[model samples]
Target: MRVLIVGAGSAGLTCAWRLAREPSTEVVLIDAGVDPGPDVPSFLLRDMVLPPPFYWDYAEFDRGYFLPRGKLFGGTSAVNATAAVRGHPWCYDAWGSPSWRWERCLPSFRAIEADMQFGAEPYHGHAGPVPITRCELGGFDHALGDAYVRRGLARIADHNAPGHLGFGPFPTNRIGDDRASTLRTLLPELRGRPNVTLRPQTEAVRVVMAHGEARGVLVRTAQGDEQLLEADRVVLSGGTFGSPEMLFASGIGPADGLRTAGLPVHVDAPEVGANLVDHPYVQMGIEVSDPAKPAAPPGKGALLTFELDGPGHLQAHAFAYRTRAVDPSADPCSAAVTCALLTPESRGRLELGTGRARVRLNHLSSDVDARRMAEIVARVADVVADLASEGALRLPADPWWHADDLPAACRREVVTYHHPVGTCRMGSDTASVVDEALRVRGVERLMVADASVMPSLPRGQTNLGAMMIGHRAAEFLLEAPPP
Candidate 1:
């Protein structure tokens, strides 16, 4: 059987690695990017624990644009902070699909993890393809974790375990000094496999469909040439924006929207590019009197879900790290805390621009969402102030600390956690693009394996969810009768 996976990101690599192991399967993975170069962002972030390779120079884009995703072989995982959180169990249970609930998804999660640390914990899987390890906790992380425990938050030894709510640095997808991206973890294992062919710098143009069934994809090669690749099946892992745009270009979205693009409507799935959700963060940097200790590096520490409720629900997810800027004479004496609003009432959408190929994200599109974000900022300020009162947490005297400045702060400082989801949402509902099994509704030989298939964003990061989807896709394909 021949399978073609589109977009050589987390999901595509996962699928390729799994399928390559099957004697009867032949897999071709195509990505529209360069090779997995040595200086890739994931490698830099994991080794140096710095924030440059993944973080774009926001000054280059409009102030509204934040957290630009990488277009490398490992996808955003190559540039992300490597925080491998499994999310709250309630996130899956509330996804409104039987196959997506925590009980049904845990096996898949367990199947892919290779726990390097905290293996004794019940929630984490010890033996798997991807390794999860705990970093050394610094003084700031230790203090922050203790603060959460003092405030009644449960201290979960392993955040990936079931019902993860507490203070602790979650396990990261890092193997020693290297970032354990799908490309690094799974691809290397399948490098010389006869059945698998990895084609980087090949952008998938559109799904090739015949009589309502997906058969292959048209790809543009690095040499600026277009070619058609045939396969028994096509899986879209182009993420929230790429997948929907591809679907729209192939006339597989809402009739009216497709019409606006001067294209024929094939599937009429109106929700293809709608219902977008993201976790927005408000970062607070503090300068400490002690200049000898720089912030602990990434993967070292994090505190999950510091809940504060009033007129609206506000959850402050804090990451305490040491930085060197605090004291030039001392070692590195600065710590920064970033609080993200997880359960925002606000929502957004992924819309095609005037040009059909262009995509624009309308973030913070709802008044309720904007207001809810404001409330979250207020609550975060309260938490920061509370921490400062104890004298251990020293927040900078920046005017951004004032609650009255939240609107400006929201505009200037808010950024995404890189967890954009629900564009190609999965559900049993007729309007959903994919079913509970992740099969494209009304389409045969086509499936979506990415965070875009998530019906809702999980409480934590989206990497684990993407990995789980890839694992589930493998299971579904393997269990089926030979094509």
Candidate 2:
């Protein structure tokens, strides 16, 4: 059987890796970005954000702020900070589907990572393609961790340990100084496989539909030539933004919106680009008390995940890193404490546009989210203030956290965590875009296996979660009896 998978990011690559191993399967994987080849730049592996020509030119969502998504071979997994967190068990249990519960999803998580720190644990796999490690804490990270411990939060040795949370060295997928993205791990294994074809610089224009089923895909080559790639099965692993855009391009979205865009409707799946959710964050800049003290190297250093005492258990993440990590032009002595609302009530939507797709992230629109995010900022600021008293760092003269209208300040300064999901929501009901098995509703021979299908955002970084989804997608396809 021939299978066509769209997008070569974390999910697409993982799905391809597993599916190509089947003797009866022939896999064709297409990506819009250029291949990374054998060697990727060492700097890209260290930095959380990547340079231009590597990202799609999506329009800025807010004032002078644009979301960055990797458009290359390994997709975001190659470009993102190698954070390999699995989030809390409650995250998966909240998906409302038994198939995606933490108990059901642990195996895939284990199968995908070779955890250096916890390999001996039954929950972690030691022989997976990707290698996971934790960074040793720098001086500032050590100080900040101590502050959290002073506040009575347990010092967690392993954040990826199921349901465990506290301040600790951030989990990352890396080998020494280099990144362990799919390009560096799975791609090497897939490169010489006879049954797998990797097509880079190829864009999926639309999934060709006939008799209410996906017949194939019409793709445009980098040189402008367009052709049909026929296959027995088509999987949309194009990611949160790209996957829904593909659905809209294929006229599988809301019929009214498709007709308005001058496209014929294939399926009236209204939720194609709805239910957009992401972590909304605001930062508190810090200045080193002594300029002579060397700043921590750029990129993620340490993380603190905790839940406030509340009804919904307001989940939040506090990351301490050099300001230059996110902005090269920023001050070398400057640092930042970013507070993000992990479980937000506010929902956004993406709409098809004449040019690029319109992404409206109504972040912090919900009162609860705004209030809770403000509380997080205030709480973390207090901790930082304690450090400042000890001559660690200096806060802004007019701190945003000090504003009388704290929630208002949060709304004015909110930024994306760059982890968008739920655009092509998956569930057990007909209203969901994809079913529990990851198959698109109202269509046959078509499936979506990426972050787009997440019903809700996981409580942590999504790269690991997306890869797990890919691993499971291939499992679902292979274990099923032949059609």
Cα RMSD (Å) per model? 3.8, 1.5
What tens digits encode model 2's per-residue C-alpha lDDT throughout 21-51? 8868999999999887877777666666677
Residue pair clashes in candidate 2: none
lDDT of 1 by residue, 150-237 (tens): 6677876677666556777668888776778876777677777888888988888889899989989999987889998998888898
TM-score of each: 0.88, 0.97
Alpha-carbon lDDT, every model: 0.72, 0.87
Q: What TM-score should be assigned to candidate 1?
A: 0.88
RMSD of 1: 3.8
Model 1, residue 184: distance off in Å is 1.5
Over all chains combined, what TM-score does candidate 2 have?
0.97
**True-structure lDDT of candidate 1:** 0.72
Q: Taking the candidates one at a time, how many backbone clashes does each contain?
A: 7, 0
